[model samples]
Target: MTTPFVHPYLPNSAPEVRAEMLAAVGAESVEEFYADIPAALRLTGDLDLPEPLVAEADLSRHVRGILGKNRTRLSFLGAGTYHHHVPAVVDEVIGRSEFLTAYAGEPYEDHGRFQALFEYASLLAELLEVEVVNVPTYDSLQATATALSMAVRATGRTRILVASDVRADVLSKVEDFIRPYASLEHVPTVDGIADVAAVTALLGDDVAAVWVSTPSATGAVETAMTQLAEATHAVGGLLVAQTDPIGLGVLTPPAAQGADITCGDIQSLGIHAWFGGGHAGFVGVADDPRLVMEMPHRLFGLASTSVEGEYGFGDVAWDRTAFAHREEGKEWVGTAAALWGIAAGVYLALMGPQGMVELGETLLARTAYARKVLTALPGVSEADGAVHLREFVLHLPRPAAEVVEELRAKEIEAGVVLGEHELLVCVTEMTTQADIDLLARELGAVLGTATDATTHTPVLEEVAR
Candidate 1:
């Protein structure tokens, strides 16, 4: 297709352009709408790229050939991204017209994209049981960083204590970004859990926020929120919880656990697990007026009041009554993918609270079962027994790289082992019992067939521990 030049200004809006357009169309009045642009901006030069088009099937086959160069495997890896099964119905439902409204609330300024944002934000607030939400930012890292910056501004504290076993990349990113502004301190871990004593020692006059992750990156659960919140409260600091939304289904929310700021990824909620996004991160605060106003992203709410003549129905708008600054008020163009994806998430949520909980429970149970099966296999063993959420790490008797290679050769994709021996495996609601057995059977066969397989599996098992 040839590129067309669009006018920067409208003919109907500009008197000269309107007259020119009328003359070009041989029309007596402006009402005759068909028009052509002036020859000056129109190109007479030849266009360079793709002068000719290929047949549809040929093009498709070419694209497929390029794509097929990449190897396919039954993925068992999940660090942040999981291979969850997305229902086909999700795509169909998100395409509905009712959900495609823009964020602009007024008739004159109605930008339909913002309405989708508002709808998404409202859905998240209702799911999280928070007063408001802002559906901006591409991922959780931005959300956390923004919230941390806001917390620093609000608290005037230069010291922030973070848990030792937090997500590795998130911590690295936060340290790289936040350390330039304040003193970033790490809370020591006690058996894969955040050490309360270490965090307590670090707290005092200059502390702004205390961050801890639940189901720590090592797969250990932390139940210290109440005390953590109390300690932060006593020292005039905020307790921030970075949660796994999948765990949220079965576990207590940050608000229920007394966390002042609840910030985490919503990736597990009906969004495709493609590259760990396009998931929205939520930063909700406890219902305290003092705390809620400090929330970073602001969602529009339906507010009502009487007009001069009579009562009137107010339309949708972004509500900032409980937010901090004007910068947060900018209308975020709803990423079409996330808005549509999360609407599916709302459908997942609306299927009822029980269904959500069951989804979480099912994941937990299946993950546990898969763990047992993996451990029973020849070269695999459980590395940590720290009460995993949906996934846990395993120690492979063979080198993780080698085992992953072997699995790949067999068209089975397995997890990557961190350090020297640990392989992280995630079992979502999508991982079936059959899939689990397939992994087990494959590992068992790899133990017998490959060169020194018998020796490597045992040697790897010892190295795994």
Candidate 2:
């Protein structure tokens, strides 16, 4: 006599509808659908789930309450992900209805979207000093993976030499993606940057590319790029350089530094670090047909329209993409981070050349000051002698992880822990001088306490002995 329960949110949950659907599918009951699943593997009894908040208002309140518990803390943690200032204009532009709501619309339907992405590619190409740039990949990691794959295809070689100092996450991604088609070798480093002599030694006929990161994971600027490129080319291999687009304002472009292919993430360009959600990858190559034909992602180009003096934007090499050939394509291309590409385009339009240079200068000045202050503290020292820009390594007396935990308790997020005593710290334009001073003071106090504890603990141990 009990009324049958029906889910308020799920459509066709009513008893009559369920019976009708089951009858239409020639199944007497829902259990019949799971007949293929073995009894041992099948779940039994009621699922351990909270009572459903059926009402929209109740669900909103529940989600808000859970989110309220998160405390906002000042963070300096940047390994691959960074915390940079996103301009208000960038957000306003991306939030528009046409850009935000549109899916993968065609060129005829989404002309504005196509033009916007083309502008983004053009602006990025200008910055990187490359001739051709793709729309974007999933992120910089994917861009790098694809770039290496392109190198393999172009050189007809299976071996890739990657710098040992690349960020761990990026290196992992490249390893996973390239394992099926190519073999990866790590080039050793000297003083935090790639050792050109070692890289030269690793190069051979089997090598397809030599991949290096400028302003590497340890924040050391790679000065031997031209040498590395020459060495790679000497063995008939390509040079792929991974760099941060934000740093190109001051640092030399990878393509200009003898890179055959350049790739990097645009997250630092007017994109908010929403728990690492905001990232889009860019890959650039020279005008050489060999390199351009190997690109898997869409490339936008401008052409003259039927109307005189009017131009139209559309995909350049549409026939080469996975969208056209499916299984036969060089690589699988899925839905891109097109929204983030648009956001980065807006940011570049706003910043222009001078603004970008000023921003780079600001970061340089702030980072130098931070290093000077923190290195002056007792029991704290620089991990490497190389010159750094936005990020650097700090050797601490205490465990870096323990220091990070203590700082978190005080509502401050210290940098990423590299090891027991090594911490990788990042400073961007968002970080102010006062913030740097505060971190230095807190770090000094923590190290002072740790040093005293170590000084006493050893004494007690010696007395016991």
Candidate 3:
């Protein structure tokens, strides 16, 4: 019997099939179709592509086998994403068809989703100590860009001053989004925090907003936030703070610290680190009607039902969303991460105010202990030279990537590589004293000096009590 007309993996790509397609398109060759293009632009070689899988494949099992090859190393690596523990309940709720099915912002279709997102926003408002909170804007990084856009639009200015210490990738994304609409200037940092003196000097009338971060990229809590807010206010610029909602438990919420606007990721609450996604972004402001109207996403508010006492949720100021007015809407993220927003609401509802506070404290104590254990190695210096929280930057003598590679050999994913000698390390509730010790011991071995067992402090015992 003749072999079926097929490519190894793409079954429809046999030579005979290609010929028929070419004939239908009135072309002798694939190259002949684009023959009008200049010779210099045309490729001179076959495309370098991966070899297709064998046709005799149990596709699902094969895919799983390939996926299973991925090593589940003990991780200390949180630069762009985190490794917070997700309660089984979060997934149990998010996985249900109702929450997962409602991506469109259709209040009529799924009233429960709207109410859940409303609860999420309300919870965020309470946590940040701000009056307004948006559901989600793509992700935390894009939410930051959206927040800055709001500041620039609100002030009617054409320039933005972003802190140099904001995550490099987030900064780049914000710069890309805002370049056509406004000019960007970066304020330098010293010791992993925004330099207050430098920030104050750069504020001017043309500046729309000054963007700063708390527990900044290096994991050091930004101490100059209040002063920066004041300086920005003095020059008629709003202070936009990018923060982690989890950090607000042990640290001051941005609103309380004089920020005019606050934006951040709420992944640490109960969202799993499914790589760079499944986390929601939030934009918040004080109780200002003008600011409320400027928010780019949907807003849900509670109202009294027909009974006059019972409450029901409904759209608050939704004319601002793209759905209400497509051509002249705030921004179109109507279908993006809407489910994650609902999931976040479930997380907040499950955790409650006291749970959030306790989680924050646990992270603080645990991270502090981890830092003490890791930084004890000779020649290791902390890059973030302030009150580091949750995450920290360590400067080692050897290249970070190389050290991390050596650690990975022992099934330990040490941290993120920031530079040749810099590693960005993160510690969360999931990170234990034994985990910290393993990282230190392996890191020390990689650095050419094994840690002395007797001298190594008992981090778990010391912190647990």
Candidate 4:
């Protein structure tokens, strides 16, 4: 059977027209084009795909029906990406054609685009309390790897130390990029935060940098960063911070802690998790020109013009990207992700400093309430002793994966399952007190042996680290 050209945008060519084109190309059949693909590897049957819809309305409804099946859960799951409440105006401003367009450094056609990104970097710099911030990278993982690369370049060292509890995805990316060039080391964590004592023990002349993630994998805020920074610097190594941009609203800025390079995902600012839709990454440089010069991606700078009080946005150290010169570029990232950077800038401009602090306080409050409520359950107890802000670990009577599936049946996204025993639950500004109460009730109901949610687990005092 012949393949049906069904999409309205795709023109259906007549058999004679196809024959004429093939004849012109000196080929008798379409199969001739695939002669080099190896007969055994070629598919033997028609693709088992649904027929395409001809009407735009039909296509829209069809897609909607598929998406409608995704249960809008009362979610508490944040292993990394989170579901934050995105304000309405952020989408409105970014959707405008002036800001929505994509490219790298088009000085003439898209000066507004350049300026938007500049404002984003500037606002993020202020929020992070760092001197300089780059235009976004792909995600936190990409930013971490890129930051590590810059550290190695700046310090001229072959050994790098990573906190074992830093997100596994980030470590894998850093390892992928740094291998065959630099050696990798781990600084272990105790009670969900990096063990600062071990970090001091591990730092040496051969080490180029130390990386630690705040509001770490278990959602425990790593408070010992200041000590880690001092130790890394005493040995002449840079401190690289893997952070959540939203956490900076309330937490100490890495720069204040003496971080040489700070990097992470900015997804929580205005971007939605969108069920793992792509997000942009960020890297902020401390007050060092050498490290600033080695930044992996674009850095938009504000400039003053000859006209009185006139200003503009442009690339600083304009030669850093692969856009103009691919082979010799520092990194191969493109400019589309910068669009997310622009959206984030809009978010910051709207939130301002006060809004950021308010957001942080709100998250802190909600998570605290959640931890208090959840731990009251009979079979659920705090998995670690760390004081958490946005997330916490819980030990359940049964397998967390099994519990998660039961919760899913009740329309809840739940938390990350570490194994048969542990569950990493996250709370955000979006998770209301009612949602937390419902979560407590559901977990109590699903565990089969749970008493009412108000009953404290008997081991609470024993595991209350």
Candidate 5:
């Protein structure tokens, strides 16, 4: 006498519809579909799930309420992914139906998509000062892995010397990805920057590449690029540099500094930090055929079509990609973050060379001001003497994780915790002078250095203004 159950969201969950599907699949009941699964491993009872909300309004409200508990106040957390202001135009361009829905396709069928990616590559190459750039990979970690793999194949060597200060997560990813093909040796650093003498000592005939990062994991700029490049080249090894594309406006491009290959993320380029969803990797190299041929991802190029005054964009060196040779390819290639490439292209177009320079100047000023203000606190000091652009490290008297937890209760995301005493702080154009002052004041209060009166005035005045 009881009516059969039917899921409001899943029409196929209706008993009659499920019966029909089971019949079509030559199965008597849903249990028959799990016949291949081992009896011991098979789940015997329904999963412990909450009752489904059948009403659309109820589902929406539930999701919103859960998300509402997350802190939405001032934040300064930037290790790899950053919080930059994404322009409305960039969103509008990428949100178009064709771009939002389309994946990889033929140039003849998806000419607009091909052209957009070609433009993205061209723009990124200019920023990196390299002759060629591939379509974006999954994220910067993948790009770094692929770059190191290329270095190993190019020099026929098995050892890679990585700077000791590289981000822990990024280092782990590279180590795991290159474990089968090569080995990694950590090079020491002084004052948070790579030590030229240390790198020189590590270089040898067996070294395939020297991996370094500008504004390294601790946010220290590597000032010894020229010396490092000479030392690496002396051993016939390549210099592979991972850099932030946003900082290239002011910092010297890796290619100009003698890096054989360059790779990094494009998350700062008009991409929203949707809780770590907005990362895409880029790899660049000079026009050398040997280096270019080793790239595993798709490369889009511009060509003149048969029609006069017409240009077409299509894949360059198609044979080198896994798409053409499958398992025989140099590395396995799969779906790329092509949409983010398009988004980045839109960002670059909006912020021409001048806009980029202005942005870089703003970051430099903000970062220096923040360091000066925060270091004035009682138990806080600069982690090192190295100059930084947008990110810097601070030494806290207390454990960094404990301090971060306390700040979170006040609805302020302090920064990324590096260790017990080290906290890596990042500043972007989006972080206002008032926000910086607020952070400094709260931090001083937390450290028992700031009085109630001093911490309250500047913030009030700035907010009132």
Candidate 6:
């Protein structure tokens, strides 16, 4: 088998770190770290097995004995972590020499050379239609923190308001990080969307920024940007949007809705399922160049003069001014190489603008179909006629936690419950008709068994003394 490319700081460095760690523990090495007078605590030699290493063919049989015990299942889980269908071309392109190999040997003296990696950030800026772009942070949570920090300082306000229906993970992050210096408020939602009147009532002079999650965690579509943006603008407060990137294909962009700071996870754009935890986000703005001026993460930029050396003439040349500003431009070198190579080069080439648009439409349609199918199941409940983005919530007969465990026992990975009995199910382009049917079937069985058992037993409600 071919050797997979290993990250520099993995098990390779574990052995070296162990040596120093053992010494600090008053021992010579790992063996000495646990070296006591008890011989029973230590093994004398290697495992009692064959002396010589077996051939590759024989080794495969040995490994299959252990791996065959566990069964792999279809996943329905999509609270924040989703399972996306990654194209084969993505893996192929990212594994190329230009991306996989270390370019540390390349001389920094050739600073003027516009490499392909740098061009990647430029293309992202074009896709987002923004003045600047940065793909530096590892995930969306970090990006949110960084964006909030920049917005607060830029507007010089100490209050931040977040929509009540924002992802719980993001809410906890904001509370923990911003609690030290700022006041945070949660604006309630009307029906499934944000309450525009409540937001307007809360808006005041002290408010620094207002954050909103379009197509909220409940999976309801909230096209409240027009009113929300206006409310924020009235008080000199900035509007920040947390959106799903795929939804932008059809829905109005936050920038078009007059948002001052637009940022969200770009994981839907050709990212893999396995990379969910580390998939980063992008922040875009329309009017504020200062938002990108001192961003926490880095971004790449290009240089183009009106005319070559036109600003320089005779003894009053401004050559130094160009270089001075050039060094401060944004760039992310290593991690972004794969995103550029695969998404821009291959995915775009294969699927033109119309194809990408169609993909987004299909995802929305599929989500709608899945929601109807789930709602039609026995002992299941949901909103009557609410439009969903790509996921929806359901109330089940049994406790949400018990239902989740039952689904897992049958080799099915289901969604998480936000409240005591409510679970959110997400359907993406990857969810086939068969996958949806299996989920419906499994859910019906579990709910029926739970319902019958509960009815036969005596009900006891706890009463307060």
> Taking the candidates one at a time, how many backbone clashes does each contain?
14, 0, 0, 1, 0, 4
RMSD of each: 7.8, 7.5, 7.0, 6.2, 3.7, 11.5
lDDT of 6: 0.64
What ranking emerges by TM-score with the best candidate at the front? 5, 2, 4, 3, 1, 6
Alpha carbon lDDT of residue 396, candidate 1? 75
Candidate number with the higher TM-score (1 or 2)? 2
lDDT of 6 at 48: 89
Q: Give the Cα lDDT of each candidate.
A: 0.65, 0.86, 0.80, 0.80, 0.88, 0.64
lDDT of 6 by residue, 1-465 (tens): 023333444554455565576667777644553556588866666678774434666667778977887654577667666666657776686666655564333324323222443444444444455555454355566556656766787788888887638887877776787675577788878777878898989988888888887667787777788788899899988888777666655666677777777676656656665524536666666535566554644433445446775221111112212223465433222343334333433444454457667877887888888888887877788843457877788888779999999888877776777678888888887777667766777777788732223222111122224
- The sequence of per-residue lDDT tens digits that candidate 3 reaches over residues 341-415 is 766777778888788778888888878887787788888988765887788888898888999888777777888
Which pairs clash inside model 3? none
Model 6 / residue 306 / CA error / Å:
14
Clash count for candidate 6 is: 4
| Model 2 lDDT per residue over 412-431, tens place | 78899998999999999877
Greater TM-score among 3 and 4 belongs to: 4
TM-score of each: 0.75, 0.86, 0.83, 0.85, 0.88, 0.72
Of candidate 1, the 10-residue stretch with the lowest lDDT total is 456-465
lDDT of 2 at 66: 96
Candidate 1: lDDT of 355? 73
Candidate 4 segments whose C-alpha is farther than 4 A from its true place: 1-52, 102-105, 449-465
List pairs with backbone clashes in candidate 2.
Answer: none
Off by over 4 Å in 5: 1-56, 452-465
Sort order, lDDT high to low: 5, 2, 4, 3, 1, 6
Question: How well does candidate 1 score on lDDT at residue 221?
Answer: 69
- Candidate 1 off by > 4 Å: 1-72, 97-123, 126-129, 305-341, 447-465
Among all windows of 10 consecutive residues in model 2, the one with the lowest summed lDDT is 455-464
